[model samples]
Target: MITQQRKLVTELPGPISKSLAQRRVAAVSSAVSGGSDIYVAGAEGAILLDVDGNQIIDFGSGIGVTSVGHSDPRVVAAVTEQAASFGHTCFMVNPYENYIELCEKIAEVTPGDFDKRSVLLNSGAEAVENAVKIARAYTGRQAVVVFDHAYHGRTNLTMAMTAKVSPYKDGFGPFAPEIYRVGMAYPYRWPTGPENCAEEAFADFVGQVHIQVGEQHVAAVVLEPIQGEGGFIVPAPGFLAKLVEWCHANGVVFIADEVQSGFCRTGAWFAVEHEGIVPDLITTAKALGGGLPIAAVTGRAEIMNAPVPGGLGGTFGGNPLSCAAALAAIETMEAEDLPGKARRIGEVLSARLTALATQFPQIGEVRGRGAMMAIEIIVPDGSKAPDAALTKAVVAACIRRGVAMLSCGSFGNVIRMLPPLVSDISLIEDAMDVLAEAFAEVLG
Candidate 1:
């Protein structure tokens, strides 16, 4: 189903999508961000057929969800089979085997063998909120420490933990209190270079957290192994493990928000594995259900058991259909050796971007792991001036040329990539060629 595409046919929004947007505006909530033009109709592998009949390469993977690609045969079959058999029974009320089976699988794959446990949820944000809840329940502490440039979720508690303020927390205030914000080990934007040593940077950031929040009152310290939406920025080497050690020493649980970087997106099941560090809790979503809404909060058995029986249950929290899809997705990942494939994809993608950087002056920084990647666009040489206009132009150019691109960052200046791990290698190379042309059109 990896068909080739070559034409835009109409404007990026096209007349059809614009009309749909008109109707959508009348019905949908305005609070939701994004455009109607980019709406998708069908997807398979790396290509998306939009409402306008335009076939676009899906570089964002629905914000990093469809790892095996949209509508994979196995996932579709599993969903259909489960939906036909039984849809809902509510885990807290009736329970089921799939949930238990999925939990066992997650425990097997997740880092840290010390009797890990997991609980399924509806979305990444919910898992994150639950992780903090478990940490608080276990440690009997009130304060939780978060880092700058970290994005956990949009839920009330998660919003408080999130770093950016503009859209995610603009009007919503009085976020859950006792939450403290600390600096991160972001190397690209750091005053020091990659050689500055992330171990040293993390040590400094941890010291600042204890000085400000006081370790005695802290429940947990949450962070992203690779900051997603905060620019696909990866923390420097030794940073993650060192921070976990610091938290453990201070009796603070360490939470890894791997919702966007988990699975095979980082060439590993979890980005934390890159440093051989096991998180006290790991929140995962996006690619877990193959496209369906599903998430999980996995952690050490003791911490997972901290919460009371009735404390964690959702009406739709482990929807059977999603569980089935997740089962299939997990199977597909292993069968396809996606972790190895993901690492190869990163090698190719990073190489292409590195070459593009040499030819174009606009691509400021190329950073990320596996298929999850990005390029920070700046105004000029060595300047941090966010080039939102330039970034928008690049995306527009790509859409016009039948290629879909997505921009993210607090300033909307970073062009992030999240192509499906199952995408055709040649198609990725083709997209790279188109991107090179788009860069010329926008930056020249």
Candidate 2:
């Protein structure tokens, strides 16, 4: 509970954590890996307390799942009250009021003023899978289009939809069929340069959809407005709007996969709102449940109702406890205006990272919006080659210094920061200070 500031009572992964790591190796699955060796005993705000009494600054936010902060009191109270009353009745069999209320809240918060309906699920991938199903059912098509360097989820269909291959999709295939991949307007690594990225990428996407995958046969075009697992790649201006326009013309559902970019993480209700575009369907999860497992697919009622009464849902979909936590999280976000908070966090991240980039040529580019930001690491050579080794070293240095950071990207050369929105200016500055020291130690 004492997490207002950072403290290091012991070295990283001291005795307690080491023992736990050994126990974990014996008990837990090998597939479940962690960013650090330190075992969390407790967490609050932006600080994670290790079992050895080391208080580390949290910059990852459990991979963007705790935007409201770890163990938020309001969320805890709501979940506790709901759990004491009753944990699960299986909403599909015996519907609950909290589930319905959560759906209403999601409809109000997500984009599009049109009549919308929602189906709650357990994770981002489930939400996306359901969205694809709905789109296909409604459009009477089978092709689902995704962009390069995109990371949807770990499910079979989502793995097929994802672009990265190493850990996510290496030996997992043969994946689902009829999934089309297109080039994203990645501004930093555009072959022709940032100036021509939007138009060229758009043209290429149109050509691919037409020539390779017929636009008429496509069910949905799904993309993250600001690519999350793709090194926080913010596409060139107007890229997403053009895609939305094309989807409209072709009758393809434009699905915004806001699992990581939604819930005030991008300084807006959803990242797509930054461009004033309304997606026909939106898939959201991560922070939506306030550290609980809950995801939802919200969209126009006509599209959402494409599936029959028993066609969509899981045994645990929209569990009462997760619904309570989601409702409380939404209330906290609205009451505190967390979107404004996220904008301020973005300003801090931009200022700190921009200054760091000026100091280190290895910092290829600093990009992202609001609490979700990242720095792509590259070799100092003019070719701008990704330096995955150097990125790993930098992240290791940060962890050794009691700051938890994350590495992501197709090539593993990007350091992303997803600090909790509730972290105050002082805590954020402290985390950035540690980051600055880490960069100086690694890049200098």
Candidate 1: tens digits of C-alpha lDDT, residues 1-444: 647554566777777778888888899898888532666778787788878877788888889999988888899999999989999998888898898888888888899879988889999999999998999999999888888888889999989988889899999998899888877777877776777858667767768776887778999988899989788888888888788888889888999999999998989998988889989999999999999999999989999999888887699888888999999999999999898888888888999999998997778899998888899998775677889899989888887777778888867889988888987787788788989999998766
Pairs clashing in candidate 2?
A: none
Please name the candidate that would achieve the greatest lDDT relative to the true structure.
2
Task: Write candidate 2's Cα lDDT for 199-295 as tens digits.
Answer: 9999999999999999889999999998888788898999999999999999999999999999999899899999999999999999999999999
- TM-scores of all predicted structures: 0.97, 0.99
The RMSD (Cα, Å) of candidate 1 is 1.5
lDDT of each: 0.86, 0.92
